[model samples]
Target: MSDLKNDIPDFQTIMLPMLKLLQDGRQWTLNEVMRALTAHFNLTEEHLKIQVPSKQMGLFRNRVGWTRSYLKKAGLIQYPDRGVYQITEEGKQFLANNPPKLRMKQLEQFPKYKEWRQTFNSGNTKEKQATRTEEQTPEEVLASTVEELRNELATELLDKLKENSFQYFEKFVIQLLQRMGYGEFREDSTQHTGQAGDQGIDGIISQDRLGLENVYIQAKRFSNNSVGSPEIRNFIGSLALQGVNKGVFLTTSRFSSSAIQTALDSKQQKIVLIDGKELTELAIEFNLGVQIADTIDIKKIDLDYFEE
Candidate 1:
């Protein structure tokens, strides 16, 4: 059995010790701090060798990096130059008044840390609940938080998509398909037909840049009512009139079981369905009808490049 004490300390567990290392009011390089922390922890040789799953850096070092980053974000430390940092006046004052040991809850006293925690807590309810528990690993908590944000964004996207007119929705679908590498140019290979007197087909996209093969589209802006088998049948009839073998039916609502079965049973023509949830996911995946608000880059050491 593995020794429980050998496990990598979480970032919160390192916060207090890390802060104390900088309490002497001297500037420190990251490497110097890392070395001091290794001695501070009194880690065994085996513990020092235990690396993250990626086999890049030791697990303990990663936690130290995260601890330092969080402290900086909370205004407890300052990075005067690359890889060099020093405790701030507020951080020194905090250490002077508090006990040598620090914990996550204690860090909430800082306004910056409190604001960061509040933002994190505002995630999906499930994620918020997971965050309150200590049983999960740090990686698990991060993954859950990301998934919750995605769910929230997808919901918002679907809600906005439903508010648009059917003609606009049709145009949006065509634009999305073009972004996904279908139809090289909008005017040449994609066209919106969600106008009065048109059949069930709303738009069309060419499979090839030359516009040889085409895929018909039927876009519906719905809220509560589910797309049923009869609606799918009407779409199939429209495809038949156009002598098309492939068709895509998109709705800002779910498809009923019968509608799904009907589409599967069609032997002559192929019909692809995109319900509200899937439509929004595709929109996000292809970077269509949405913009990236922020980006975070998670980096790991490249061990092989540095090997002798």
Candidate 2:
């Protein structure tokens, strides 16, 4: 069943009810509150099973967690211990004045909430006002939107990389390494060793401008298969053949458990592994092959400027 099929309440929608659940001023575990919330919302068993896009956790649970986090940030609740929380005295006082239903605008009355909103919306006022809605918290909306865009970009990047040739992949890895300050100089620091009879070494880089030390590299452009222990051992052997002690194994795929263990247990050399996800993250971070499409700056009030 599609996880999105269930009508999941947004974080804002759950905030007031969640706060009310702790009105008795007694400590409550996350599990207890979640159960109470499930009953309060009248959600069925099937509804409870509705998962998030990642399929790692339930959508309703995620929303409740966010709701709790926002309340904590606003100082309306306190964490007494791991997974346990309680309503603060300020929280009870809030309930005394406000109605059962609390809206985001109403929450702005609290200093902490107001400051949080100002900080979040600072210079991006137009963007924030356009996207702000009653159903979602500003932080949740922004985070989820960024995550969606990032996931899409990652998918596109992997697809484009997979379509390229192995030789192209090797050069791409070298370019990424160079961008990350691996090679001291672009002209002579990096050398491709993936030619015929080059053993298992795909590339090498001088760690410094003087070429005092070298770092061996192995780039594997595998789309789906895992780089296992045997491949890692072969790379280490290639490093030994070159008499190098530092190496990096770059793969457009995951490394097996045994492969990771082998790299860690190696006493003769220091081996660093870059799997597909990590590689894509680095590519995005360093702008290796990607360009920034837009940028936003958030600003805040300068109280000192107006102070007497």
Candidate 3:
């Protein structure tokens, strides 16, 4: 039983209005955009799940960002702050002159997308248009489009996880590794620490059979606090006793200069460290414990029919 559905046309239809809203001088957050989109289109969160296909707020932000990026690259919009976006003067002129085509050709005007569009439309021909259109189900089209944008968003989130929390932060890392096909890892939830509370390891995973191969994991769920080198040294020490050469240190907080140097200097085992941002990204990539919400379809125009 799956809860996924195809609804891409919904997004193509919404992009303009989204742009216009930004153009109209209304300042809106991602959630506000979500609510507006859902209301104006008579859509629900369920509808958006298919239209955008993610349950995370960050996903929605990422979609808006892609839209903004396309618009901006085309000289249509601009970002004034971390969460704020506004339309540009060129956006007004483009809207006034162009009748608004939701296909890639129109979106290609943006410099950032020129290469992508050129490649996408390279093989397109009138005779083959109909066949290609029919070949793609609405859901499939949306899935592909959203995935491209998701990759960009994942890259952005990767940089932000380093300043967040260890609990949720670590969860994202574990999920990412699992998604990458690394399994048999569990988080540290032990209640007793033999007088040194939770000192054994943040988490552990067996990369192979025979229990001979393993990677030690440490997730620092710091809100803004920085993790220093002494902690990293301790984790390395634990790994040495087990003769494991691979370890991962993840933190919602950034690591100190000394700490990072120490991990590299340890020379005993290789340690991979993931901060908060990277953790969230891995979670998205792995789809660990995450569910798909909805899908959208973007269709190209049949110009040949008009020429005929």
Residue-level lDDT tens digits of model 3 in 142-209: 55545555644543454345334545555555556655766544333211112235564655666665
Q: Which stretches of candidate 3 lie over 4 Å from their true place?
A: 1-175, 184-197, 299-308
Per-residue lDDT tens digits of candidate 1, residues 1-308?
15733565666778888899999988999889988888887776777777766577878887787688668747799777668889999899888887756665566678866543443343334324446659777777778767766765665576567666777888898887788777765568887788887898888898787777998999889865889999999999999998989999998888899999999999999999998777888899998777886666778899999999
Predict model 1's lDDT versus the native: 0.78
26 Cα displacement, candidate 2 (Å): 64
C-alpha local distance difference test of each model: 0.78, 0.78, 0.58
Range of the 10 consecutive residues with the lowest summed lDDT in candidate 3: 187-196
Q: Name model 1 segments beyond 4 Å from true.
A: 1-124, 131-133, 302-308
TM-score winner, 2 or 3: 2
- The order by descending TM-score is 1, 2, 3
TM-scores for all candidates: the values are: 0.57, 0.55, 0.43
Writing each residue's lDDT as its tens digit, candidate 2 over 1-308 gives: 56544466677778889999999999999999999999888887888888876677888987787678668647699777768889998899888877767656566677765543442332222234446655678776676677645644554475467668988888888888888988744678898888778799888889887777988889999866789999999999998988889999998777899999999999999999998777877888888778886555758899999999
Q: Quote model 3's TM-score.
A: 0.43
Q: List clashing residue pairs in candidate 1.
A: none
